[model samples]
Target: MEIRQLRHFVAVVTEGSFTAAARAELIVQSALSTSVRNLERELGAELFDRTGRRVVLTEAGRALLPQARQLLAGAEAARQAVAQVSGLGAGRLAIGTIQTLTCVDLAGELAAFHREFPAVQVSVREAPVEELIDGLRAGELDLAFLAPDARRLPDGLAPFATWQEDLVLVTAPGHPLAAAGRTLIRDLAAEPFIDFKAGTGLETAVRRLAAHCGLERRITCDVTQIGLLVDLVRAGIGVAIVPRRIGEAAGLPCVRIRQPEPGRSIVLAGRAPRPRNPAAGALLDQLDRLDRFDRLDQLDRLD
Candidate 1:
């Protein structure tokens, strides 16, 4: 029988009469009776003994009472579960990020999300921009933080938020470049550079800037992690051009680039038109709230 029928049956049993059950259910007594009758007919069993002033359960009614109550309870539980997910109370959120996370504090945002929706499971993945885009396309990720090339995003993904950031030259404390208050792009043309792998957006921006200045980059070391690149610079292996925020965080000596300054637009990307996950929608709502108050910088303060 239908859930509605089961619900009416349970209400009648609890209220001890069809008239009271109808009043409790906000329905007419005759309609309630019809529903109960239809359910009894479907089950091929008499659910109540009506030969007395007050309605009471028969043998078959007693047998089905527990099962009908269980069915109704289960249906209610299902509705509540869906409501929790729709309201962002519980679910899993998969977030992807580019290897370098200088533009925004991804961990902090995750922490904020956790504080707000503790029951939601958050998963983070670090990869190259291309790989992040692939993950988005494949529906493996709910959101991504990336430095897109010239505002060029993947076909289906749209930028939720974007900000421009400059790239700076980083070196050891006593390095020759550090002594120079400011450096020009041409000055580092022949210097040994610690660069990211070829497929990274950072590397592409470096190469583009180098090409603009008519110089070929001499990559002494190739690294994947920004922290590792900073460590290499600290050890005097070679210099690196990275986001200013990264250099500042590393506490390395940073020199401003004068000519062909390398920079990129960082964006929070997600599926356009619609997001498949309810948790993703909730995260986007949080992001929107943060954006409205210009509080994105506050993410840096979170651990």
Candidate 2:
């Protein structure tokens, strides 16, 4: 049957009477009644058994009710998908991220996004992984870049993309373990350590590593900024665990953890739902383009 006819059919079932459905649909009662009648005629079954004032659904009507609703819902979703991709009007994107984003250059991507979609207001919040997850669940943030704790994520949060990276122990030039080819966690039990504040991704992962090795880390210093944490390590405040790429880039001694080698997943996560924010969708599209360009550059190098 026609979509309009199905819409009218659902309205009548909802209001329980032709008069009420007509008022609800903002049409004349006769028109609503005619639409339902036409639908019934096409199906070759009497839908509603009209008893005095209240309308009751017949067998045919009961079966059709669910399918009719499904069709209508599908139609609405299609319409929204089309509208979102057609254009981006004025909007805003509230984004959250972790302190260490070594895998992807979010700053550079956001800068490019700003130049292209200047009308879209974008705000970034840097927080620990736990806080970022809470923000997404509470609807305070639209999307987040996180070093997720392994592959598990909250039920409603889904990753848009994931990149793997190694976590290495960083120490200054003069530290005793700095020159070790590969060290074990038990070897550092007595040494002072520099670690990120609790609730952070790196700290949590490092703590898990310590627990696995059955040793408590002597965290003599706690820092919020990754750069500051690295600097402290450079100055011999204490040894710290950091991303391999970041530690190497900082010119620090990055020793591999031979036992229980820890790795991290850098993921771009968003809430699982239909009709995502148009601005967020635009950002994803932009990232896709940039990723394609990066792949092309890699291929050129190979050539």
Candidate 3:
């Protein structure tokens, strides 16, 4: 039977009279009576037995009432779930970012978002540019903060926020480069360098700059994570290049590379901006604000 017929049957059973059910449903009593009759005909059983002024449930109707209620409840639940997924109430958000995003301060921001949208579940995965892009396309990540030159994204991807950050040369406190306030690219040819391993944004940036300078960096260790690289650098393993914020946070000495303009643009990319869920939109807004503040802070430092 149709869901509407089942609902009409339920209303009649609840209000104990066809006229009252129709009044409650905003339908004519005759229409409600016909709907229930049609439903009974489809089921090959009478749902109610009328006794002049009142209607009592048939044995079949008594057995079917719980099932009908369950079906209507489930339908409503499905509707609400779809609405939540469409960004109305609560949903899950997966975010991807590089390991060296020290300036972004995602930790505090995530905590705040969690507090604000307690119903929205947020998860972050750290990966290199290549892997993040792969995850984004593969539907593993809902949003991503990726460094520029992260390969051309697929047509489906859309960029919403952008910012520039300076890259710097980093080494342990007493390393040779640390002593030299600002180190040159050529001067680093002899020093054993700690490099970001394959599949990392910093590694790509370092490789690109090396190719432009036509210099083979003396990489003694290749690690995937910037945190590990920093630990190694702190132990005097070798020198490395990374975002200035990371080096500064690691408390390592950094020298700005003069050639090749050592800086990279950061961008927030995902599916279409117009169709993003409320959680995703909230995240996008926070990221844009963060980027703007970072730019202003950088300008103030320069001045």
Query: TM-score for each prediction?
Result: 0.67, 0.65, 0.65
TM-score of 2: 0.65
List the global CA lDDT of all models: 0.79, 0.78, 0.74
Error of 1 at 169 (Å): 0.3
Model 2, range 1-303, lDDT digits (tens) per residue?
Answer: 898898799778755688878986789999999999999999999999986557999999999988887786566445445546666545667689988877878788889888887866677878989878976775546789887765567778776766767999999886777766589888888878998888888887788878888978888999888899989999988989888988999999989997788877677788774216777777877887777223211211221
lDDT of 3 at 109: 83
* Poorest lDDT segment (10 consecutive residues) of candidate 3: 294-303
Residue-wise lDDT of candidate 3 within 128-214, one digit each (tens)?
787787666644466788874644445677666556779998888987667776866776778888888776666777888888888
lDDT of 1 by residue, 1-303 (tens): 899998899778766899988986789999999999999999999899999999899999999987886675566446545846577665667788878767666778779889988887777778888888876765657788877655457578776666667999999889988988589877777789999988787887888888888878788999877888999999999999898988898899989888766787677777785466767777778877777323233222211
In TM-score terms, which candidate is top?
A: 1
Clashing pairs in 2: none
Q: After superposition, how far is residue 264 of candidate 1 from its true place, in Å?
A: 0.8
